[model samples]
Target: MGALDVSKIVQGRQGWRLITCIWLHAGVVHLLINVLCLLFIGIRLEQEFGFVRIGLVYLISGFGGSLMSALFIRSSISVGASGALFGLIGSMLSELITNWSLYANKVAALLTLVFVIVVNLALGILPRVDNFAHIGGLISGFLLGFVVFIRPQFAWINQKRVAPGQETAPVKRKHKTYQYILWLAAVVLLIVGFTVAIVLLFRGYNANDHCSWCHYLSCVPTKKWKCNSSPQTCTVMQQPNTLDLTCDGTGTHHSYSIAGATQDQISQLCNSLCS
Candidate 1:
């Protein structure tokens, strides 16, 4: 098909942009890296669990990453399948943890994979990669995999006698109370984690420094007491009056002022009055 716009995919008026954005990416390199990762990890998972389960994991993990990004990174546009790929990796790690017996050498393989990913994460700190999304996806995938794949049950148990001559001890079933506790803990952790992510995202996007009033005028410290109403009506305030004033970037020209106060002083006064 044709190229897709990530902003369009994720820019819903209400909030559904989170779902659509995961499928879109910025460029060829971006698309290739994610696709390769997915192909390697996702295909294997699908083969084991069937397509439906794999699809569910991908969707959930992708959405989790998008939600986190939307809440945290407001200025820059983000588009990629890296989050979903990371989630798949997390799932693979979980599978290794849960079924160590069936999958021989899984522990070693997982450790290697973990090492590679950690190094990549460290590299991500240098520049443009959205490390937060990668982390969110990985954690979400890991949690989902643990819940779905590792439910407490003894899949292997020997109860019947192999032959009449030989008697064997009945295999005892291990209590799954700990597993249940772990499941509960995982659920609680996921909820708390997502909540914290959302809060931080919102806080970061809507920082006090990005206030409309503060950025509108470009007044310096020395000319703090001047108020400019418009291009024509630049006025210097005799006293510090808490009124909104618009100023050009330089102190030479004040765009306009609401009262006889500097923009900073006006903002403070407004906050105090509102409070």
Candidate 2:
């Protein structure tokens, strides 16, 4: 029930849709894709980092995705967990980097992961896909991974394993200096990014106003297909015993003979006419 409706969010102040929309999907195909991806990517991360960190990455990343989508795509409704899925992908990349020494076949793993990320992002440019969400989730999760996934240096870990009271040189720091620097920088960036995005969103700033070419990142027109940015609407005219409907997108008209019809019925009829 919680598909993202931009008007409800901006005009009606229903900000909670940003979170609720993540758990909703447009159709069975959409739900299956998200669920399968979640199982494939989430299981390993949850096993390694536990539920808390993974859950945080999921929810925050989903919100980040919704915020970006709201800013750019004011028309139409959006629903799905693609943003959260991208966040997991982003976190995997950052985790590999932050814990580079702990992993084997570093170069090979990095290449494979990079390839996968690039391919998925490329797919976002297609029509009806929200690339902005993918991008926002990725950035949020990448920064978060550095902060939450920092591992202790091997020397520090070995030092802890030493027998009690045994003579051992002190491993001055648990984590490398670079890790600390990255963690701090990532935290600061995350705060600043979220602050700016929220402020812009509440102020009713449309990202499309500033970036003319940004829409191409979400969809590109081709000879066989075209992108539709306008929201679906219908103009209704009612008489005592008949109703007339006109689709705003296509200007197609339909007439129904009925004594009276509720709003939901009218909406369903309009949708059918538009379709």
Candidate maximizing lDDT = 2
Query: In candidate 1, which residue pairs get closer than 3 Å at backbone N, Cα or C atoms, i.e. clash?
Result: 71-201, 72-201, 228-256, 228-257, 229-256, 229-257, 230-256
Model 2 misplaced regions, further than 4 Å: 165-167, 229-275
| Residue range 1-275, candidate 1, lDDT tens digits | 21222334344333455566677888888889888877877777887888888888788887777765554344346678777777777877776666555566776888887996787566444334666567778888888776666633443243443567766665555425555565576678778877776555444343222344432222212233322222222233443433332222111222233545556664554433221
RMSD vs true structure, all candidates = 11.0, 10.2
| Pairs in clash, predicted candidate 2 | none
What is the C-alpha local distance difference test score of each model? 0.58, 0.85
Q: How many residue pairs clash in each candidate?
A: 7, 0
Mind giving the per-residue lDDT tens digits that candidate 2 earns over 157-195? Answer: 999899988978888989887888889999999999999
Evaluated at residue 20, the lDDT of candidate 2 is 95
Q: What is the lDDT of residue 217 in candidate 1?
A: 21
Model 2's TM-score against the true structure? 0.82
